[model samples]
Target: MTRLVVVGAGLMGEAIFSGLLASGWAPADIVVSDARAERRAELSERYGVGSGEAVDAVADAQTVLLAVKPADVGGVLEEIGDRLAPDALLLSVCAGVALATLQAGVREGTPVVRAMPNTPARVGEAITAVSPGTHATDDHLAEVTEILGAVGRVITVAEKYQDSVTAVSGSGPAYVFLVAEAMIEGGVHVGLPRDVATELAVQTLFGSATLLRDTGDHPAILRENVTSPGGTTAAALRRLEDHGVRAAFLAAVEAARDRSLELG
Candidate 1:
């Protein structure tokens, strides 16, 4: 029997499967299914995993993972809903799709879980938020935590908070990238070569994030630690505040949250 069947061969799907393999899942126990034959062939050649149509992939599989786009969720579920074995776990990483919607698509009492994982899963450093569906129990959630933990940190949140999680962590990476872009450009403006600026910005962000994580210090406390009275960091922060950067971020997260609600 197949242990896991991933219903999409996209980036996140590939990430989870690759992470699993890296953590010791055998190739024969996993199968990847994609709508495009070329994609299916590419992953099979690259990873040496089995490939098949979605329906065939899920057969006798203990877990079915849906990594498709939100728009494709309904269709994919429709194709495999009734086909899933009664005890099989259905897990999804599609954004903006609700548990009710997923549970409705599958057979009655089928265990479903909704998860929001960011792009960093590609590097095994993602922070994923998972919420259980109506039929999901503690055992099912523990299984999900183990599966997702292979890629990154897994946090269980109430389903009601998932939209907020979608806004904060799911969309958070893009915001960090934008900040990195601006920082690199700022370095260039200060007479650094583009490559030098790029390296500095990347390392600074990385080091700062590591510090924040390792020290367990509040971000504000960390910022204050670096900002001497009337120093460069202080000057920069003053300018940022003058430009309302903090307010902009609040607005941005709220906008993302509202959009997620609309999508759901």
Candidate 2:
């Protein structure tokens, strides 16, 4: 059996297990650990992976998924650093934790893969970006990619880009939601019913994205295709420019990236 272990058993931890299983790995081959007794029991009952202690769960796992919080990763890695299998791979979903920090806990020279996945993964519509540490080989990365890609689209970037990835895709969902919220309010302001406004705004966003994705045209081109001179879109664009929306997005993402670096 191809043994895989997931630590933390939180939302992302559990989501990782679910993603692996959906990608064809059997429950018998996976193990999960959580510090809280209730979480362990709950997950074991739900997924059938035994609710063992962290060290026990990861003891022989071929790939250990570090799904703990950014702050907790160091301690967990330190705790199990010496106990992991010599050749086992380390995969982490904890944002802001650097590759070097992860390698410090595991066996010397073990492979490590770091990933940033957004909240949409809960519904299987996530976008994730991954970067490998120095020890991670192509084959090892492929394995990690396969696991993360199960939940959504996966992109591989340099670790140098992970912080930006965190700000964009990782924090991007919230930005989209905020836009949706504003659109819905705008619709309501214009006399549309709340529910109808929400549905229309959401569907428009989804349809626009779908069209852009399916048409294979660049976003700039697709957007230009929609905006006629002196059109409604152009009017909205002027209002958005007046409000400095684009600048706000740049500032927000840049601030998030800086904060991620600061946290690490």
The top-ranked prediction according to TM-score is 1
Candidate 2 RMSD computed on C-alpha atoms after optimal superposition onto the true structure = 1.4
Q: Model 2, 1-264: lDDT tens per residue?
A: 237888888888887788778878788888888889888888888877766888876777898888988998878988888888888999989999999889887878989999999888886778888898989999998888788877888889999999999999889989999999999999999999999999999999999888988999999898889899999999988899999998999999999999989877
User: For model 1, what is the C-alpha lDDT against the true structure?
Assistant: 0.93
The lDDT, on a scale of 0 to 1, for candidate 2 is 0.87
For model 1, how does the per-residue alpha-carbon lDDT over 142-216 read when each residue is reduced to its tens digit? 989888988999999999999999999999999999999999999899999999999999999999999999999
Report residue 198 deviation for candidate 1 (angstroms): 0.8
Clashes of each: 0, 0
Best candidate, lDDT-wise? 1
Model 1 lDDT at residue 2: 84
TM-score of each: 0.98, 0.95
Off by over 4 Å in 2: none
Query: What local lDDT score does residue 61 receive in model 1, on the 0 to 100 scale?
Result: 83
Residue clash pairs of candidate 2: none
